[model samples]
Target: PLQLSQHRVREKEAVKQSGVKTAKVKGVKNLEEIKKAIDEIGYPSILKTCSGGYDGKGQWKLLEEKDVKSINWNENVEYILEEMIRFDKEVSCLVVRGINRDIVSYPIGENSHKKGILNKTIVPARVSKDILEKVEKTSQEIRKRLD
Candidate 1:
């Protein structure tokens, strides 16, 4: 088997919600905090999993944060959560380093969704010249953090 130490990707991807009150999502320890986030983010903000939230699966597009207000507290559990941002483009870029210290980057992909499910992917996305610059710049920032 290939020597693998750690290749896990921890994600907290957010959509751009310009007018949304992001501070409303203060902490993510228990039900109360989650409820507060709902109250603040309102419905349809994607909530991602901290670990088990595989590829945004545990994610929910809540329509009303108060939806939790109506549910009885069965347990003090919460999904690892965040407020989803609305972005014109959703993409993923990966950088891999082999034991040989060789680094490779998979081509960036332009993503699409169907019923909240990832549907299609276009590698080497055909974005506008202007948007392409923005994507490259943003991807660079993310790579820096991962390093």
Candidate 2:
């Protein structure tokens, strides 16, 4: 199967594209670089690993400069800093494709997160028609690109 379905792949593709607005992100090697990244990405940014994470476990939120100073970077690991995005609601969609080129997408689901962990899912998110359409379209587009 195509690996483009992964978060890392999606992020790289987003960096090259123009439609969706993804968080501005950068990698750093040392504390000085981390400071520079904070200046560029701004406060309320997020620092996360590029792989092997789920349920929001491998990330840190920099709400202020103090949070940045509080961090103790592990030289053994790699990290990426991303500007935090402000959104009213979070929604997700699931897409499945078969070997015969058949694709199917489920209704968009509204996601409620607390402390970065998904707390609830409301099927067919209570969003406007336009937003729902956009979410579904995006899911389909991702499958197409990976296909």
Candidate 3:
């Protein structure tokens, strides 16, 4: 659980292996690797620390070739370059598992972010029933894989 929570690359790999769709991501260790990944993934992508970053603290958006030069790369810290995903709304579902292996999920919530910080969440997200079911199912799948 700790590993899955801390390592973004590992978590994404596990989710991908679990048959969940995710944005294209590449793990990079330095500027050179980041450049290579950018070439492969293309522009308008994001660079984020692999661990210990919260509330959008360790993130950089490379909107174009010139944007890459603006980041102060740290060779010592690992990073993940991800293709930027555009979406209309952001929703999240929380799943809890008990010691006896019983699992339950809360209703999906619509999330709003301000300057990359989570602002508020509205429970019972205003989404189609089909989308809600899919989100719950995806959350369950992730929980199973992480467990």
Top-TM-score candidate index: 3
Instruction: Write candidate 2's Cα lDDT for 1-147 as tens digits.
Output: 344334553465553463554678887656788889888888888887666655677788999878877777777666778888999999999888768968788888999988998899999899999999888877766556555
Name the candidate, 1 or 3, with the larger TM-score value. 3
User: Judged by lDDT, which candidate is best?
Assistant: 3
Q: Residue 51, candidate 2: how far off, in angstroms?
A: 1.1
Candidates 1 and 2 compared: the better one by TM-score is: 2
Candidate 1 weakest ten by summed lDDT = 1-10
Model 2, stretches more than 4 Å misplaced? 1-10, 14-18
Q: List the residue pairs that clash in candidate 2.
A: none
Which residues of candidate 1, in runs, are more than 4 Å off?
1-27, 39-44, 69-78
Q: Weakest 10 consecutive residues, lDDT, candidate 2?
A: 1-10
lDDT of 2 at 24: 84
Each prediction's RMSD to truth: 6.2, 2.4, 1.0
Per residue, candidate 3 scores C-alpha lDDT tens digits across 1-147 of: 778779889989999988899999999998889889998999899999999887778998889988888988888899999999999999999999889988889889999998888899999999999999999989988888778
Whole-model Cα lDDT of every candidate shown, in order = 0.54, 0.76, 0.91
- Ranking by lDDT, best first? 3, 2, 1
TM-score of 1: 0.65
lDDT of 1 by residue, 1-147 (tens): 111111111232231121212322333546767767666666565554443444446555655656555544334434444555666887766667788978677777888888677888999877777776666666556555544
- What TM-score does structure 3 among the candidates reach? 0.96
